[model samples]
Target: MMGQPPYSRTTIDELLRLIERAGLFERQPMVERKIMHYSSLQTILLVGEGNFSFSSALATAFESAENIVASSIDSEDKVLRVYNTARSSIENLESRKALVLYEVDATRLHEIEELSTRIFDRVVFNLPHAGYFPGGECSKEAIKKNSELLSMFLESATKLLSLDGEIHVTNKVGPPYKKWNLEGAAENYGLYLKESVSFQKADYPGYMNKRGSGAKINRTFRLGECETYMFSAV
Candidate 1:
């Protein structure tokens, strides 16, 4: 049977507002755009885009990608948010670009391959933390689930990547960092980590509301860690 949806109306609405107000909407676009210029990839795939915010950034970055496919799982209220965000991004691009968006379990490779129809030059995984859900609970079960999901996501993504394609992943490693090591997990999926970059607290704009928030911060701090990794296909 299908599992219950991941989000609710109130939670979805609140997250959306926070994302917009926090300027994450713009941040995602900027990140993708920069990567586009830096990597010079011809095609890209995005997995687990909860609301197309990051996808929008990618769209702006690769205006003429050979192919672009994005996927997310939408069961309950998450469906509303995902659809709305994706639609908004699509409208913003306003170009008949070869972009395909799917509402599917991001961990499923067959589904992704079906939609993409070919290997991609770039694959991205920007997943949610274990405790980001409404229940606000994190357990071994949850971590294991996320790990398995990520493993499958990588397996399929690699299979669909071009010979020299690369996979990019971003995740938050919070306090008591004893749960799951994403870097280790990626290796389990047969991906070799090539490079890792961290964005310091000073590097990004302050957390939306702050006393001296003018421009986005570009320095590191005790909290707020952003990690990016480039992995080669095996």
Candidate 2:
């Protein structure tokens, strides 16, 4: 039987208010514009979504049924322990008819038989961190792991992307995050960097950053200079 239509987790008007409050509505119009684009009925894949906060926003912002595929590497148990979000929260997405898959590694996406033939209009990965560390610091090992993960993800995801489609990856703006070289990593996978805009919490009103992995803070206390990098197949 066909599942019920999914409900949005948030609204554009609400998000706009948050962006305006953060004083980013003008300076970061790029990401805001992208968020607006999601309101259309487009096929979307939200990868590396921990606790599915951003994914939930996408569902709320989107206007399609079973069009948003939200995936995370961790299993339900891990999501519960690390994110403190009940299994029902994640299960509710599926009940809403959004395809919510736990334990789906973005890098190893080809392994998922169901997703093998899918072509998404928008593929998104937010704050692609290996996990939280001392004060949200990513060590050299964490840096390398993230680098490899991003590279593999770009390579795999590009193959499943539709033409005229775009891939979006957001990350911490500085330090270990910048070292991953998001644009460079995409280029290595035959993808071209399109545009990048600074990320603001206000831009996504109902969205929350769940660091997961035993992290103390849900939102990492950092310099608060995150950026959303967009890319497309070259």
Candidate 3:
């Protein structure tokens, strides 16, 4: 469920190297991977997964996917077709007994029969954005659509969240993302920002951030200054 500007690149490291070579950005030291915040014992729900790599990474880290539930907005068939590695990821999740759902809209989590009565300790949505549009990522239309999606998702997620659980949304830190003003949107849903933490891809060993849309749906995107914004219900 992440939306990103059209990029044909393969990996963040490759893109960063290109930037450094062009002298646009100075090379910085590599970030050490942080320990994952989600625990294996916790009931976790991940939404809007592009290729389910994040879920697969978690399952591998935990040595089991028994406590995890992963979902996608696209149909299972569509996911398999678009993402080159999806079949194996889904297989891994399934083999580990992780609940895998398809076409589960982010704005209607509670309405799903399988999810209606469940509560999760950690609910994560990574790189949420509206699908590609004509005017590109910075267009007013893009921001508005993405903001509305965030707002509705928060409202829905609040209903399914455990009393002491957290809702996590990871996104790029600046520019068009900042314009979305997630803090303001959370307040509208009676949720408050608890903290924001740096999002390092290395933290999730097998996780690959996909463009998640358009012709390059299978391609990875550059993650610049991304942070995981954790929110709690008021």
Candidate 4:
């Protein structure tokens, strides 16, 4: 999930625009729609959904799929708007299956276990709003804390997944860095970094400008390379 600070309005807006342009907004929705159309699955869980914008888009795209559950944890009032919009869209579905929505902390596995009674075939953490917020520190302590929080996120997510299920994650690779080091933390939690999809400069929208240039650049790029990672259970 994207764990940036939630207070950077410019950064958040730009990231959402970039996400829309990159087709990520539709990618998972289409996958869920197709899977439900041709296969059989009872439930799906979306964790750390932030504003639930992506969840709303997925609901619209997969309206025909039954028993789909989407959720998020945003104490902010804006999250309610997102929930209402998605809930309204789901009312048009031909099937009468319910889409559960809740406001709960993701780091607490006991809360999740209490909220959701079933294992999910698909679990998603698009991006979280923790590390990159306005008050968040980029110091050594903050990075270490962020890493630990990310590890906890994985641990809780694993508990919600089916044995053969997959977890799809996306994150910006460090600038000027070519490889991501997932050896220590990921291995400690029985999770593996699967593969990364690289996008060229043209593939990302409004990311050409350097940082602090008044342009929004959430995904960092150096030497003309930018990417996001996908992880799964070992």
- lDDT string for model 2 (1-234, tens) is 998556444666788879889757875322221364464356788887777776666555542336778888888667776665535446556665788888888887767876887888888888776664554456777777778878888888898889988998878777877778778888887788888878887666467776555536344444388877889884
Point out the worst 10-residue segment of candidate 2 by lDDT: 28-37
lDDT of 3 by residue, 50-139 (tens): 899999988877777888999999999999999999988899999999999999999999999999988888889999977998899899
Clashing pairs in 4: 1-127, 2-127, 2-128, 4-132, 5-132, 5-133
TM-score for every candidate vs. truth?
A: 0.63, 0.75, 0.84, 0.58
**What value of lDDT does candidate 2 attain over all alpha carbons?**
0.73
Q: What is the Å distance of residue 72 in model 1 from its true position?
A: 2.0
**Candidate with the larger TM-score of 1 and 4:** 1
Candidate 1 Cα outliers beyond 4 Å, as residue runs: 1-41, 75-86, 93-96, 129-138, 174-178, 199-223
Q: On a 0 to 1 TM-score scale, where does candidate 3 land against the true structure?
A: 0.84
Off by over 4 Å in 3: 1-35
C-alpha lDDT of all candidate models, in order: 0.56, 0.73, 0.89, 0.51
Residue 109 Cα positional deviation in candidate 1, in Å, after optimal superposition: 2.7
Q: Please give, for residues 79-193, the per-residue lDDT of candidate 4 as tens digits.
A: 4443334334334322345454556666664456554556766666543324443533455555655566566767777777777666655445562122223334556778777
**Least well predicted 10-residue stretch by lDDT in candidate 3:** 26-35
Largest TM-score belongs to which candidate?
A: 3
Alpha-carbon lDDT of model 3: 0.89
RMSD of each: 17.8, 13.6, 19.7, 18.1
lDDT of 2 at 107: 85
Q: Could you tell me the lDDT of residue 27 within candidate 3?
A: 53
